[model samples]
Target: MSSSSQEPQLPVIAVVGPTGSGKSDLGVNLALALNGEVINADALQFYRGMDIGTAKITVEERKGVPHHLLDTMDVTQEASVADFQKDCRAAILDIHSRGKRAILVGGSGLYVRAALDVLEFPGTDPKLRKQLEEECESKGLAPLRARLEELDPVSAARLGDARRVIRALEVHGLTGRPFSSFMPQREYFQPALQIGLEVDREQLRERLALRVHGMVDAGLREEVRGLDAIGLRRGKTASRALGYAQFLRVLDGGMSADAAVEETIVATRQFARRQLTWFRGDPRITWIDWQDPELVPKAVQAVNAASPASA
Candidate 1:
């Protein structure tokens, strides 16, 4: 460690919060204050032409802070946690090399952990995945889920749905280890401080509803229509984006536009609740109230205290 008198090494500062809690604004301000660049961890924001639904920040909103990892993937591509880990770490290193801090911002808990924590992503084999997929299709998900319960009860209980069940089995088959064994620890990959935004439940619900309405006004319906033209439904991840999924129902005649809009608001609220649960479970995060008048200054204080001269 260097002497206490020298400037300390820059940490990868992370600004985390639920959707519509102003994470983007806080991230941009933090970057400006800390001489940092923002690295997006939101999975949905990774896709091109996914701006409106994901509530991605515009170039003007970025306020001249260089943002990385946005719009790097096409809607047709799957967003992999493994791939994101590799890319996000590279961006952090590049920023640090250039003597700038890296501010990772997003509400995707798993993706955030992948970027900052000591997380291991199990490798995949195509043949193994295909064989397992076939087994799932032929014998049904019951047997595979039962087998997973026998081997890795943790993952079996946690992972719901056929796809995740098959994935767990694949990990066990290839690595001879339980899929749950790869869960991330709280340990940071490098020096880092996570500043989470805490918002009032009732107020956030109101805010999210208004935000979804604003998206509709901002041509979200048209954006979804255009993406569907290019096969949005075929893109597993993109197709299920919060507003995009409901809007697709509008396109398919299963639901009216107004109904889709209501469902999107509800879905966004539920998602925000889940995000809060995930972040609240982590004890290491230093949280600031989203409505705090001096949010930036408080965040900066947390950052400085996190990595002191002795630290």
Candidate 2:
């Protein structure tokens, strides 16, 4: 066991992995063991009334541990990692000030990095952004995408959709630098321990499919129906979330509930793969088997080993 020392450590613990990997449960267990509180980093879980689709942990599942940043935004508001970085750091500071360990938990890779890494978000120009948006609306994404490919091929390759492509163009236009140039380095702004859960790929595929089916059974359609009334479709980010986006097709009479469920499962699996690729690129995270029976104890050991005194 690592011993405490007079030299202070920031003492932030992160539980990260692919979707359906039980990160939330592990986070709660680690909190219970280490007397910590959780600060959520999952982007989808930020929306209010998005419980069923996001697979948010219920009150009973929280086991009395205080969770921060869950359901902090309405579905109609756009979720931004830059804004999340501020809120998450504040939550961590407040937790540490209260003499409690801050447990950062979620699968959103960028949000987790934004909280712990030394990342700088570039400033935006409203007028320039408006011009780009107008172009995207009138000429479509291909022209803007082609322009980005010319200016910043790396960013163009990385960004999948029009919103992100346009943002990359805006950033380059404003800063005279490629958006990918702002990629975070492998240094923490604070002392942090990242615990990643590993799973068998085939098993994860099956698990994710079943999980989507479970979400549908848990009234995901009704959940989307409720959010639609609150202008969910108009929300840039929330409207495009995994389960919610697919179910919107059902509401549009474009597909059946079964088709929506299947599409969600497939999309979720692809997303999980992307998440794994992103996390695997970072060498700092300590990976553990998801099925380990002594998971909590192992996580506690990792935390202790990463402490400043242990170092």
C-alpha TM-scores of all predictions: 0.95, 0.91
Each candidate: how many clashes? 0, 0
- Candidate 1: what lDDT? 0.93
Prediction 2 global C-alpha lDDT: 0.92
Residue 107 alpha-carbon offset, candidate 1, angstroms: 0.5
> What would the per-residue lDDT of candidate 2 be over residues 1-311, giving only the tens digit for each residue?
15433557756999999999999999999999888999999999999999998899999999999999999999989999999999999999889877788999999999999999999999888999999999999999999999999999999889998888988999999999999999898889899999999999999999999899888888999999999999999999999999999889899999998888888998999999999998998899999999999988999999988875633
Give the whole-model CA lDDT for all candidates, comma-separated: 0.93, 0.92
After superposition, candidate 2 runs with Cα above 4 Å error: 1-6, 135-162
User: Taking the tens digit of each residue's C-alpha lDDT, what string does model 1 give over 35-71?
Assistant: 9999999999999999999999999999999999999
TM-score of 1: 0.95
